[model samples]
Target: MSAKALIFYGGWEGHEPEACAAIVEEMLQAEGFDVRSEAGVAVLGEADLARFDLIVPMCTQVSIDQVPLERLCTAIEAGTGLAGFHGGMGDTFRDAPAYQFMAGGQWVAHPGDILDYRVEIAQPQHPLMEGIDDFEYRSEQYFLHVDPGNEVLATTTFDGSHAPWIAGTVMPVVWTRRHGRGRVFYSALGHQASEFTNPQMREILRRGLVWASRTTDSRETGT
Candidate 1:
């Protein structure tokens, strides 16, 4: 049977949740996942969260209720995969520490808002970064509070041009971590669906999803 993947998208329309969901859905479908897409956090409460092999949350600045939030985290801990990009995953569930804890980071600022910046591959030998080189893209340069345990795949250096305090900061742009038995992958890029349309961005996102889904308990996990 094909692996099941659920995409829950809603909240903060400015993030273009629907558009981002569509891009992610199409990509996962092409990869042979049986994909299910939903509009709001309500669906999260309604479903048996553990049924799927992967969950992609395409939301930003949204409130997820306690019950569903607990189930979602539990599901991941028990071995479901979670992956997403930008605010969709990084900035979601403001009040939920479990969500942020598993995601390995939280979106604190963009530094310069939307602008041009370069992404550097930090672990070129990692499968997620394989064949992907340092590239330039225009979008929000996410400044995040990240877990030091994350296996960082790519990063970007802050030039302090936007925020003087953060100048010379090197931030993780893509990373993967294990939350219990689950594999969690995230990228700081993809502020808009159009951003994913870029070949390089799209490839990274797609590969990240595939990597997350295939991950298993053989991978290490910790606090």
Candidate 2:
């Protein structure tokens, strides 16, 4: 059987969650995932979440009920993979530090909001970043509250064009970590679905999803 993936999206509309979910769904489908999509928070509580190999949370600025959030976290701890990009994962629930802990970071600010910035590959040797050179990007330059546990893969230097005090700051752009036994991956890229058209952005997300998923053997053994 193909691997399963669930994408739950909805929250602040300015982030274009619907369009963003569609793009990610298509990407995962192409990757051989038996993809399922849901809008709003209902599915998070109701779905048979443990059956899936991966969970992709795409909600932005939304609050998840405590019971559902706990359930979701338990599933991940039991080895269900979790992965997403930009605010969908990085800035998901402002009120839930537990959610941020699972995802590795929270979006604190975008200094310039939408502007030109550079993304530098920090772990060029990692398979996820291989052949992915540092590139210029136009979007939110995310200032995040990052988890030190994360194995950072990419970083960007702040030029302080918009926020002078932060000039020369080195911030993590991509990382992978663990939520118990479950693997978690995130990239502070893809502020909008359109950005996925950029090969580097798309490839990193694709590889990150694949990387974050449980191995077939682990899934079968319930590990």
Which runs of model 2 end up more than 4 angstroms from their true locations? 216-223
TM-score of each: 0.95, 0.95
Candidate 2 structure quality by residue, lDDT tens digits, 1-223: 8999999999888788999999989988998899999998789899988988999989898888999999899999998999998888887788998888888889989987999889999988787888889999989999998999899999999999999999999999999888998999899998887897889989999988888787544234211
In candidate 2, how many Å is residue 84 off?
A: 0.3
lDDT of 2 at 23: 91
- lDDT per residue for candidate 1 within 1-223, as digits (tens), equals 8889999998899899998898889898898899999998887899998989999998888898889999999999998999999999998887888899989999999877899999999988787777889999899999999999999989999999978888899999999998998889999889987897677788888888987884432243221
Q: Quantify all predictions' global Cα lDDT against the true fold.
A: 0.88, 0.88
At residue 108, give the lDDT of candidate 1: 90
Off by over 4 Å in 1: 214-223
